[model samples]
Target: MNIPSLPPPVTRDKNALVLFSGGQDSTTCLAWALTHYNHVETVGFSYGQRHAVELEGRPRILEKLRQFSEKWNRRLGADHIVDLSLISHLSETAMTTEMEIRVMENGLPNTFVPGRNLMFLTAAAMLAYRRDLNTLVGGMCETDFSGYPDCRDDAVKALQVALNIGMDTRLALLTPLMWKNKKETWQMAFDLGGQKLIELIVSETHTCYIGEHNRLHEWGYGCGKCPACLLRKRGFMEYQSEKKPI
Candidate 1:
């Protein structure tokens, strides 16, 4: 999971709207944006997914984040939770539907929801236009993606282009984790807010696809076998191992 560091963090003079999901990656992205953006707001969706309960923890996560840094929270806007149940109805994937989680011949898994990311980015862009924001941030990553076509770097780049052209506005789509692995993702959270932010992410963020939170793994509370949980635990373990004293 070792990878080169990103060139540099972008400093945005304008506000940033994050496509948050109250999950590990999105929380990390939110923190990342807070460190760089002058003003930051989060937007999440209630798409009737299996893990819809994850949305329940958004407010608490924000509260803790706000408490962590008043300077960052001063410009934080309210979380915009959109009702996107139609997205769930339109998709027949495991994430939004009851289906076996298996990788298909096309390299996509049952968790892959076609056009979900596109729809999300489009919605976030529209919201950004209304808010006069110039940036849309997401936590999508290709390095440790779980067979999701939408999470690919190429797809995200192409969608950004199409979104800008369709909206007739110049909006920068920033995927901070685009080239980073899960281990690097953990490290980024640590680098951004030190140990406090890392603790918040580990204890508060929800990344379990099946919504299991009782049992705690090294990464956090999850079933530990689902794709999401496995990736998180492995990344966390790698991050810890790499950070250990020689």
Candidate 2:
């Protein structure tokens, strides 16, 4: 694999907690955290999403990462599942409710659960405080996304500042995929842990907004029509195209 130039390896004493959702981007972010941080923990949210199937794969993905290598097994730490069910009550978006996925008059996808990432980070920050983790990592991306304002880099950075000020602690918020599109994300997985990680991502992670897992596609098990599945599929195709012989 042709790996891109990456940031310097994190110091062994630096600890991080990843916001893992068992989706393609989050899973890749988990792997990225594992590759960089010394001690890495994970936190997932139970937001009553329509596609809650991703939650079921969280433990399995973590276990597989543990088994992938001795180093990862040693570095991986505790996992936290936060109950943010209030999000479902607050919003009737397609992500939180059973509704057709489409863009609203606001020109944003109805799948945008307002303040979801903000809340996720807030909860993750609280957990990190208790766990003494200083860095918080997420898969939020702006390069190839559904135009969700919360996923923007500025929002994440501002949140980090607010979190640190509110808690009176310096908590670094890291978004590895902030500028990277999906194809680069796939290449990142391959670079981080080789074909095994790519295989793990393709087979184990869930990204469909509809919770469809029985039917498998080249990218993974998804409805293949939803925005999430479409992005994953296109990224996988681009990634594979680059790998083919000229």
Please, what are the lDDT tens digits per residue for candidate 1 over residues 71-165? Answer: 88797877898887888889788888666678888877778888888888888888888887888899999899886778877777777777667
For candidate 2, lDDT tens digit of each residue in 1-246?
Answer: 222222322544788999999999999999988988889999999989988999999999999999988989999999999999999999999998888999899999999999999999999999999998888999999999999999988888788778777998878889999999899999999989989998999899999998999998878999999999999999999999997453
The parts of candidate 2 lying over 4 Å away from their true place are 1-12, 244-246
Q: After superposition, how far is residue 209 of candidate 2 from its true place, in Å?
A: 0.5
* Residue 87 lDDT in candidate 2: 96
Please give the lDDT score for candidate 1: 0.84
Question: How does candidate 2 fare on TM-score?
Answer: 0.94
Among residues 3 or more apart in sequence or in different chains, the pairs in candidate 2 whose N, CA or C atoms overlap within 3 Å are: none
Clashing pairs in 1: none
Give per-model TM-scores.
0.92, 0.94
